[model samples]
Target: MQERIPRRTLLAGLGAGLVLPAAARAGDLAAAGWASARGGEGGRTLRVTTLAPDGPGSFRAAVEAAGPRKVVFDVVGVIDLGRKSIRIREPFLTVAGETAPSPGITFIRGGIQVESHDVVLRHLRVRAGRDGAPDRSGWEVDGITCWKAHDVIVDHCSIAWATDENLSASGPRFDGGDTVEAWRQGTSRRITFSNNIVSEGLSHASHVKGEHSKGTLIHDNATEVLIVGNLYAHNLERNQLFKGAVHAVSVNNLVYDPGTRAMHYALNAPEWEGRAWQVGQLALVGNVIKGGASTRPDLPFLIVEGQGDLDLYARDNRAAYADGRPMPELRVLPTTPLPKVRRLARPPLWPKGLKALPASAVEASVLATAGARPWDRDAIDLRVLRQVKDGTGRVIDDEKEVGGYPK
Candidate 1:
């Protein structure tokens, strides 16, 4: 029973104020061969090796026969539901579920549910249905839901076991009284979860407590956002009650042995009304934080308790703290020194009466040497003059000779 039009009659049968040419804009190539010939008859564009034979309902009847617009799913391998069990039911839309309300794929129990929108699930490998669980209906419900999806891309996939957590959505479920019921709804914008490899569900593992899972970019989703090079060796109370609010950008990831004793970052907003923890721009760069001695003496690679203006940045890291304690004050910044004089707008190619030296004679030969300062402008790697500094060092004269010029 799915045929309810009238979103202005599906934008007037998609000819709503039309305009095409300039090679049919929208990622050109004649608008992707007119969206792969409206997605059928050797459908011109939906590669993943041109998947057919009815699955994802022949990719939702090849995106409603590619008529509407914007289709690009270049997933090169693994669309094997060999042990068949792929379900996506519900009002579904796609474009990443309408700008990103979360769910390129999801399935939460109770008579199974699924949704879609502006979809783009790349390099696919969606598993989770080896036939296990259903005494009261749980594991074995292959999921994928997306609402309000826009510009969504779950790239380079390998989404595993998934009793849960490849993509999530939340809001609603406090029924003691009052009027509210939102066990994860929508709102996702410009979403892009690149280089994926999500894992979970050894035996019914997909537990996500809610608070409207925030905007994410979760770069390199290490084992499904376990954080840093993914390493979860055994369920230590669901990896210490895994939480989320994530305004993410977490880089290089490698959260290895975090069974407990470490890993805690909370800012509870008492069910969203008090609404605290709002991390805007965070960029933890080049990570490699090793086990902090079983982790929980007071874990904090980062922990903000809400307010706003949270613009953090951590560079070239390599932390360690498994009870050998001594790594706090995680507010580092001081490693700037590398210039000495190297600015060439144009001038290079030796021997022809070579004479190209003046930036005030390389700043008076680096202020006459000796721990050269004067804001040591960096860039001078003149092979440290072949290191032969004996006669109490200090020599550059020859009229401040710089590129081949000492006759």
Candidate 2:
């Protein structure tokens, strides 16, 4: 006689523990942009019927023409561009390109700039294509940039290969000097950065540069950011730079093969500059950093190269070392403290619907969904898919290769 084991128990033991939390369902995910942007939900629909970069019925024209209307301009085909950047100065708008006929708009020499509040940009692909001139040319610029805008959301978009940063949120500021009541500058607020692929930036992956700088846009006061569920890869450094900001929450992001630095939270204000050196706030939670065997030690799981006074709080961050083992701790791997550190006592504000998935789950979810894509687009070319986790290539837009949501 043999003892029979229960089928349910056996099946449970065999499971690989791969599950998407019910709280993070697709319906909830779709509404995140609207919620974050204070109802930037793009009330009306303005279908873009062509691939023209910036003329009649084009993306730029529709957005510029849309006055006093909370409209969504849905792009239906891949729109190519030359030297002119698509600039938007309106409020309460949505630009959707998830259903483009081709891989979406490929920016050979231009990018986009949003300068208003309550805006949503979804499932669009803006890549500074590889070609003639050097990357130093200012014309080969950022994918999407915002200045002093608030309650904005960027989701499921793939932006890459920019001479500057792939994405930036900045505004203007004055260098506060010897005492006449120091005042704040044009600072952006309540901005959500999530569910996207930002990579191959020549200088930085994402630049949140604010304060007294030469940058066209500099937002120094009251900049609060919600950054989560994104994929950062193949960028040289500055995965996310907090040059001048007060609050930012970084969670559940997958950083695959970052170069010199994972993040730079600094007060770039020079010694002769303003009192802005004493401003910063950041929190790192549940982020997974997967580095190759060749990654340098200085660029560890995370690094701090800013003024020691920068307020930083880190927890539950995991890293895969060069030898392919989980890093035991998330301590600064340096031999000496760059400067006497300043750890924050208060934690960052967690958004309403953010769920903390495991490091593995987060990586998988980002890999499957981040970029000019849904969770179901992955029929990639061998040249691209081979380096999807590390190097840069033609990111395939085939939703068929992707599996179910967070499977």
lDDT (0 to 1) per candidate: 0.28, 0.54
TM-score per candidate, chains pooled:
0.23, 0.75
Clashes of each: 61, 8
State the displacement of the C-alpha of residue 351, model 2, in Å, after optimal TM-score superposition.
2.4
Judged by whole-model lDDT over C-alpha atoms, candidate 1 comes out at 0.28
The numbered model that scores best in TM-score is 2
Superposition error at 1 for model 1 (Å): 42
Candidate 1 on 156-218: residue-level lDDT in tens? 333333343333322122222332211112333333343333322233232233111111122
**Model 2, span 229-260: residue lDDT tens:** 77776555566666554567777887766655
lDDT of 1 at 104: 26
In Å, residue 118's CA in model 1 sits off its true spot by 16
Residue-level error in angstroms, candidate 1, position 34: 26
Per-residue error for 240 in candidate 1, Å, reads: 22
Q: What would the C-alpha RMSD of candidate 2 be, to one decimal place?
A: 8.8
